[model samples]
Target: MKIRSRRFKHALASLSCAATLLLAPLASSIALAADPEKEELKLGFIKLTDMAPLAIAYEKGFFEDEGLYVSLEAQANWKVLLDRVITGELDGAHMLAGQPLGATIGFGTKADVVTAFSMDLNGNAITVSNAVWAEMKKHVPMANGKPVHPIKADALKPVIDQYKAKGKPFNLGMVFPVSTHNYELRYWLAAGGINPGYYAPAKGDITGTLSADALLSVTPPPQMPATMEAGTIHGYSVGEPWNQAAVFKGIGVPVVTDYEIWKNNPEKVLGVSKAWAEANPETHKRLVKALIRAAMWLDENDNANRAEAVEILARPEYVGADAKVIANSMTGTFEYEKGDKRAVPDFNVFFRHNATYPYYSDAIWYLTQMRRWGQIGEAKPDSWYFETAKKVYLPEIYQSAASELVAEGKAKAADFPAATEEGFRAPSSDFIDGLTYDGRQPNAYIEQFSIGLKADSKL
Candidate 1:
């Protein structure tokens, strides 16, 4: 009887040990999935297709999966969106890659804005009116009757000269002053030897058209086509589906994509006020995790899921454009002329090439553009550029969220930068003019440009 009792006790102890072993991993996962301090959130976005990660996160239950109930609202414009985020009216929003940097540095509205996730890469193009295209086409090289790709700004310089000879101000449109569109347009024109102008913020001249060749002004993204159609502007730089919208409406020809201007350039980011991020650290991480998952779903299987993504983006609450128009650029092809669709698989990268990671190098590039264009107003040390990038871009938060996703088996570890990544990318001359940009050497990179402010240059 004593032997049987002892055997029963031993079996019970073994069962208890096995149960604990099984529950260990479960507990760790639960800890990782801790309740977010703020469960209900309102986020804002503009009506652009690159806001896909936020849309995908909300549509696919990735937000709910992370214990977040998010209401996605489309703001009227970028300034309004930034203001709302700054006022805590919206928890976060899809932002231009330069917006946070601009805000943090007191360029526009002084606010402590920061971004943990880079939303997408290379979704913008410069579109010229049909009339402008007709004039510019004469200078472009022909390939079997179709215009040669990339259509450098050199093609448009003579056209600008014609406008100048006629005494008409050569005007162009960019979404915002600090936007990638503005810098890209300036870069392309400067590369072609047309001065895009400068901003003397110290003199309160934020007009950015001092001593200009091509006068640039702000036009909201969705209104780009109509504004150009009204002849208010000759050409504009903006993101999809607006560029594609021009092709569909037969209003303009997308001469060059930002992908052509600067291969795989960072476009937009997921931005929130620094206070919000500090107040809800857990929520922020969960938000990033959901977005990371959404991005993975986006690029997985060679973008096999893009068709469905286009459908979601076409919904009235999101981009609200026709599915066909959105799909023109979203699904690995971009329409230049009405039928000049070409395969550009990396045109709208969300996950691949560490697109989701907020590299410091990307931030510094925007800073360099600001300085080059005089928005920064003064030369900054290379260390200052690095420090400012560190202030605005939170890679640690991204890594934390990514690590959780990898541990939970939702994402592969290889999908992100290695653990030793110092948040800088290797130097490459990916610009349309073949100028090398080493993020570590900002002044040297700035000096290579002929048009804008040099490293020691003053306004």
Candidate 2:
């Protein structure tokens, strides 16, 4: 309804634009291209602050600028969101970075899902209950009467061992089996010599607790605080608002952020079925363009707009968390322990560091984690990794959309990766364990992980 009223106002203004356009020839030449194949779209998202791109695009009229009227619906959970996208119940949805790759590879629900846009980076943290934190705090190194930053999983390892000694399951919650939260949590735990466990899908054991020292299960993001409070789980790995929710509730303390786990790690993406993309290529590119604009707005001027963006995300139609909770991390700062707020401007990065680029390296990293954890039961060549990443992460589509924006002078050419980019990021040793990852060499990267399945290893 708001979009309709906005369109009506635009129509009224267009009647007076002819005279102005005649005086400004450059503006007339900069007009948008043909309308999208599908003008009306319903998109889906989970209730997380990282979904800010979709909310901003809708609220700021970016979608309408591309001649698209969009509806944003919050899904019940990740699985339902992915299923709806596959079934075309929604045009596209905000998805975990691994969802498209996982679906394409037949990990859970086999389908040809693809993404042309990455939504954001580094918006997750691992939090522990006050009880767990109390025990873990004894192991953590302290400076200035507070736990040192980037509290390694080694501190939590002793607490997990104690729980095992008592014969109690040390369960943790991630949003989904193939979620970035699952892999990031596993990575942090394994880096500390704790086995977060393996998935034996080949033997029909999809639960990833086969050899885990800590059992991990899926709990929806909104329910993480309540679940940890109920003692059903000791801690959780999740996106913002929820992690901050735990601190506000005073039931838990965030131990480490994903930015500390692996700096600027890819988090979420805009996913659609291959069928929908092929059928509406123009519409797909237009959608990516609008989302790109939204992301730029979110991170521009050193995040000057983040406060207003937080207010929009706090609305009932979006993330719906209290504005204070969303602002805790969204406003360029993260509160770990109570009264321990620290500056982490990149914690919820939307566009900076080329955050919106759908890099094949990012996709291959997820595949490497899946293989390392045994969800990918067998090993594959590096070539397979590259090919699979290309199939799912369509950087060409993203580049096409970005080029349009640059041509329109809405974004600078330097804001995106070069056209000659081969889709892999440069090698980096940014993990908590300081392991180097070269996306071009997936098997080598997988072999470097001591706790996971090594090269050619079978479950």
Candidate 3:
């Protein structure tokens, strides 16, 4: 009986050992399952503080957290960056929100580009050259020796008229034809009763000023201040540091910010080729995870890390602008006219308010703008807008990363859109002109705009 009992005990111990072995592989599989795809990645960006999330993700090891070895490169211009992404030279890029939409729609280049992340909100401002600002200030309203916030272009209308009467064009610069700077500049100018003009690509007039009061041209971000200083352009609309650079060099005065034009506006996005995304879905999700973490770090605690972000952007590899220049708008205050500083806490929002999610509504808005201004010549059905937005903004891929973050307790459900979400935002009326925009009814929205081409309207 004693021998039989000892044999029974040994069998029980063996069963326990077997159970431990079974559970060990399960845990190992769970851990190994979390590893990233395509461990090495190269990303591109223009020299704007809006690209800080990419720099911060790399610098703070967020990419490493996802097992991604990322190399962030600053390209010469937006065109080069977009081309590189199309050709696989860049895995992804910090791009204009319109860039992916434009590329997918074959505005400049034919490529299937997608954005799962929006890099930032409201990092652009319009600045006028010192000479033009001097003339504009004479017409602007002042109280307590300060120009009122959101100094409208009404003040500059007469200056443009002077140029018009003199038979010389009133030239201004924006980064790209489909850029936020282009649209925002146009919006502000149109709102203040300035004719920013139209694009007739079909007519071979890509200059975008068929009949104009102000001839808006495309100048790359880094060239804005230098172009203004050389008197080549009277004013420009651009993202970060460059606007403040105008103030530092005494070349120009920033008249209004996009935040003032449209509060908390979506700006740049992280774009990748459709081929890259399809071939390496896991790598794409991992990249989104790293960026989302970096964006959170940037906006956490009411932007406690903004100082560090400004420093990172000032480094030669990122924005490469003067630290003081970058700090002007990056650290919660923006310098407009020389020494005229104001508190703008949300000037460079990165993560909060669902800023990282690539909303289909945001994509549709850019497309609507393109259609409104003759970039898209003919009227497209509302379904076309929805289809185009879905093509460019991949909410499915974004949700994958968001789900992983929630499961790991890294982020909360409240931080993103609800688990069951419709791609479109509930009709946004937040534009500068207070025009209600229902992405579902894009043609109606385009028709309501006071300026540019509308439904059945051609350049």
- Measured by TM-score, the strongest candidate is 2
lDDT of 3 by residue, 59-133 (tens): 887787786777777899999999999999999999999999998888878789998888889999999988898
C-alpha lDDT score of every prediction, in listed order:
0.92, 0.93, 0.87
Candidates 1 and 3: which is better by TM-score? 1
Locate the minimum summed-lDDT window of 10 residues in model 2. 1-10
List ranges where model 1 is wrong by over 4 Å.
1-33
What is model 2's C-alpha RMSD?
Answer: 2.7
My TM-score estimates for the predictions, one after another, are 0.93, 0.95, 0.93
Predictions: Cα RMSD each: 9.0, 2.7, 9.5
Residues 137-212 of candidate 1 have per-residue lDDT tens digits of 9999999999998889899999999988999998899999889999999998999999999999999899999999
lDDT of 2: 0.93
Question: Runs in model 3 with CA error above 4 Å?
Answer: 1-31
Write down the worst ten-residue block by lDDT for model 3: 1-10
lDDT of 3 at 85: 97
Clashing residue pairs for model 2: none
- Whose lDDT is greatest here? 2
Model 2 vs. true fold: TM: 0.95
